[model samples]
Target: MTKQAIEQTGLIPRSIIRTFDRFRIQLLSGTEKLVIQEFRISRYQVLVSVKCLLSLIILPILINCLLKNFLVLPLTTNFWNTHQQQIFLNSDQQNRAFIELSQFEEKIYFEFLLDSFNKNPAFNNSLSSSNEASISNQAKNKSPLKTLYSDKYALNKLIREDIQRKTSELAVFYNQESIIALTNLFGDVITFIIIGFLIIWMKPQIIILQSFLTESIYSLSDTTKSFLLILGTDLLVGFHSPRGWEIFLELILQHFGFPENEDFIFLFVATFPVLLDTVFKYWIFRYLNQISPSTVATYHSMIE
Candidate 1:
C-alpha cells in the first residue's frame, strides 16, 4: 500500500508523517547548500584559499594567547594577591597536598644529611676505615660525632622548626596554585566566548573554512587518510589510551581546582575511551564507508 493511501486512511499517524517530511526537507536543503559552498570554494584562487585556511587556523590561536596572558592571568593574579586564602576545595586535595609536601620534605632532609656527612672529615675517615670496632669507639669518643649522632633533643628541635617553616610554605604554595587554576579556568572561558562571537560574526568565512577543510581531507590519498584515522584512533581510544586519559583528567582536575579523586579518574578512563572508540567505529562505518570504501578497507587492514 502507498504511504499516502495509508496516511489518508488514518492507519499512519499525521504527526509522524509531518516529522519525516520536515526532516527530509531539511536534510536535502542542507546537503544542497553544502555542495554549492564546496563548488564555490573550489573556484577560488590558490593564494586566496591558502590565506583563508591559514587565517582560520592561526587567528583563533593567537587571540586565545593574547586574551589568556594579557587579560585573564593578570586579573586573576591581582585578585588572588589582594584576597589570598590558603585553602583546599576538599579533604582529598588537602590530603594529596600534604602527602606531596611530606615526600618533598623527606627528600630535602635526606640531601641535607648527605651534605653534612660529606663535609665531616672524621665521619668520612671512620666510614672509609675497615675497622668496625675502631669506628664504633671513635663514634663514642669523638665530640663532633657525638654532637651529630647523640644529641637527639637538639636534632628534634631543628627538625621541628624546619617542619613548621615548611608547613607555612606549603600553605603559601597551595594558595598560589589555586590562583593559577582560577586563571586557567577564566582564560578558557574568555577564549570560548571570543570563539563563539567570531563564529557568529564570520558565518560566511566559517562556511568557506569548513568547505576548505573538507576538500583538503578528501584530496588526500586513501593510504594517507587511513593512516591518519589509525593514528587518531590509537592516540584517543586504543590500548595505551588509558594512561593518556588518566594524565589528561588529572591536569583538567588540577586546572579547575577539583579534587583529584582516583575513583572518578579511573571511571572516566575506563568509560570515556570505550565511548570514543565506539564513536570512531560508527564514523568509519557510517560516513567513511559511504564516502571512500577503499579507505575503510585500508584502515581495517592496517589495524590487523
Candidate 2:
C-alpha cells in the first residue's frame, strides 16, 4: 500500500506519466546486454555517449567565450553599476522620459511610413487637410499596433526601421572589435557530422551501444522514481537543508532499506537536476532513434 501510494505521487499526480509518455521506445532492456563474462562497453555506446555529451560541453564553452570578450574584457565587472547610473535606468524618472521618446519616434516614423505608402500609391495622395488631420487624430487614439498601418501615424514604422538599422550597426561594431561571435551552430553541426560518420563507419557497435543506453534509461527510470519518492517524502517531512546533496552522498547506503536518521534535504536539491538531465537527454535520443531510424541512419551514413 505504501509503495503504491508513493508511486502515484509527484508535483502533479500525472507528472511521472507525462514525462515517460513522450518516449517512443523502452530505453533500457533487461536482455540488451547478455552476460557471458564481465561487463564491457560496446563501440556504439561510446559514440552515442560522446554524441550526447557535446551539447553539455559546448554551451558552457560558448557562453564563457562570450562573457570574456563582451563583459570581462570590455567593461570589467562594474558594467552593472555603470548602466544603473544612466537616466534610462532611473525607474521613477522613466515614465515621462518614455512618453516623450515614444512621441518623438512616433512623429518621425509617421512621415517615413507615409512616404512608403505614397510611393506604393495604394491610396490617392489627394486627401484634404481636414481629412488628413482626422486620420492623424484617429491614429493617435488607436492602439500602437493599429497605428503602424495607418498612413498619417507611422511612429511604429519609423521606430522599427531605426531599430533595424541600429541593430545592424551593433552587429558590425562587435565584429570589427573582434568580439567574435562565440556562438556558431555550425560548429555543433560539424561536430555532430564527424560523430555520425564515425558511427556509420562502425555500425554494429553503435547499434549495440545505443541499445544498451536505451535499456539503461528504462531500468534507471524505475530506480530513479523510487529514489525520488523516498527523497521527496524526506524533503516534504524532514528538515531539508538548502545545501544537502553534497553531504547526502555518504549517507545513502545500499542497505536493506533507506535509513532514516536526521533530515537529508540538501543532497536531493543539488543532485536532482543533474540526475534529471541525464535521464531526460538519454530519453530524448532514444525517442528520436525509435521514431525515425531510417532517416537517422541515413544522416549518420552521410556524415560518416
Candidate 3:
C-alpha cells in the first residue's frame, strides 16, 4: 500500500510515530555531539571543561567575597554606625535585643557579685577571722563587718555603671551583627547580578556545562544515585527537617534584617517541607520510575 493510503487507514498509532521521530532526532543530536567530542583533542576538552567549572563554581565565590569584603562590609558598617538607632528594622527586633540584653545583664550581675566576694581580701580576712571567732565575738564583730567590703550602695552604683557599660557593648554587638547581615544580603545581590550577566554572555559555555553535568550524573552508578537521592530527601524533607528549616528561616530573616517571627517560621516549616516532599515524590513517580526504576526501588528499600 502507498504510504499516504496507509496513513488514511490510521493503522499506525500517532503516539508511536511521534515518539519514533523524537528518538530519531535525539539520536542524530547525540551522534553529532559524539563526533564533535571525538574530533576535539583531549587537552582542549579538558581546558574547556576546566573553564566551565571555574566559571560555574570558583568565579561566583570569588565575586561574592570581593563584593562582601570590599564593597558591602565597609558601607554597611559605616551606615550602621551612623544610624545605630535605626539598625533594628522594627520594634519586634528592638524588643528582642533588649530582652537578650536584660538576660545578659542578670547573668553578669550574678557573676560580678560572686567574683567580688571571692576576690575581696577584706571579705576573705573577715570570713577567716569569723571562723576563728566564737559566737559572742562574731556578734561583737557584726557591726564592723559592713566595713570589710565596699558599701552596699557603692556596690549598687558600681553594678549600675557596669550594666551601662554592658548596655553600650550590647548595642555595638547588635549593630555589628546587623551590619554583617546587611553586607551579606547586598553581597549576595551583587554576586547574583554578576553571575546572571556571565550566564547571558556565556550562554554556549553554560549549555555545554549543563550537558556535561547531566551526562556525568547519568553515568553515575545506580546505587550512588539512589544513595544521593535518599540523603538529599532526608536532609530536606524528613522527620528532622523542621528544625533545620526553622534555623534556615531564622538565618534568612536575620540576613534581610527581619524579625524572627515564630509564627512565620512555624508556618514555613509546616508548609514548605510538605510541598518539597510532594515534589520529590512526584519526580520519583513520574520521571525516576521511567528513567531508572532500579534506582527508585533501591531508594525505597534504603529508606525503609
Candidate 4:
C-alpha cells in the first residue's frame, strides 16, 4: 500500500510544468564547444536581442496603454459628452422642457411651435373673419370632420418634413466622422509601410533569423503551431495587429501560468521579443555556418 501511494505521488501533472523535460534533456546534451562555436558565428546576436526586447515587447504595451487611456478613450468620451447633449434637455430648461421628448414627439412639438410663433396668427385672423363671411356665403364646402382631418394631415406632414431634415443632418455628420476616421487609418498604414520597408532594408538579418526560429518552434509542438497559424492567418486576412493579436498573445501567456499582475504583463510583453530573437540567434549560430557581418552582402549572395 505504501509503495503504491509513493508511485502515484511521483507522477507529475502536465498543467504545473513550464516545459517538457524531454526538450530540456535534449537541449542540454550538447557540449561547451557548441556554445563557443555559436558565439563565434553571431557576435552581434545581442544587438538583435536588445532591439527585439525594446521594439516588439516593451514598446507595444506602452503604445497600446498610452493611446487607449490618454488619446483614444478620451477622444471617444468627449464625443459621447457632446453628442449625448443633443438627445437630452438642459438642466436649466427642465421646467419648460417636455419630459421624455422622443424623436417623433420632439419633431411634432417643434413644427407646432414654429407654426404658432411664426405663421399661425395671420392664418388665424384670416380664418376668424372668413368664418363670418363663410357663414354668409352659405358655403356647403365646410364640414367639421373634414376640416379636422385636413388640419391633422397637414400637421403630420410638417412634422414628417422636420424629422426627416434633422435625421438627414445627423446622418451626414456621422458619415463625415466615419470618412475622417478611415482617412486617418489610411495615413497610419502608409507611415507603417514606409517604416517597415526601411527596417527590411536596414536589418534583413533579424527578420530572417526570427522567421527561421518561428518555423522551427512552431513545428516542435502542436500548440505553438496552432497559435502561430492563427496569428499568421489573421495578419494575412488584414486584421489590425493590436486588436487581433495583442489580446490573444496576452491570454496565451496568462493561460500558461504566467503572472496576471500589470507590471509582470508589461515585463513579459517587453521580454517576449527578446526571447524569440535570442532563440533564433542561438539556433543559427549553433546549427548553421557563420554568415557575413553585412546583411546586404548576405542578401545579394542569396539572390545570386
Summarize candidate 2's per-residue lDDT along 46-87 as a digit string, tens digits.
666666456446644675556555545455224433443332
Q: Candidate 1: what lDDT?
A: 0.77
Error of 3 at 190 (Å): 2.2
Each model's TM-score, in the order given? 0.69, 0.22, 0.74, 0.30
Instruction: Give per-candidate clash totals.
Output: 0, 15, 0, 1
Ranking by lDDT: 3, 1, 4, 2
lDDT of 3 by residue, 258-281 (tens): 777899899989999999999989
* Candidate 4's TM-score: 0.30
Q: Write the number of the candidate with greater lDDT, choosing between 3 and 4.
A: 3
Which candidate model has the greater TM-score, 2 or 4?
A: 4
Candidate 2 achieves a global lDDT of 0.47
Kindly list the per-residue Cα lDDT of model 1 for residues 78-194, writing each as its tens digit: 877777564654576688778987887687668667766776778778768899897888768765566567645655676778888878887777777777778778777887787
Error of 3 at 44 (Å): 5.2
Query: Which residues of candidate 4, in runs, are more than 4 Å off?
Result: 1-50, 53-154, 157-161, 164-168, 185-189, 208-212, 215-219, 222-304
> In candidate 1, which residue pairs get closer than 3 Å at backbone N, Cα or C atoms, i.e. clash?
none
Q: What is the lDDT of candidate 3?
A: 0.77
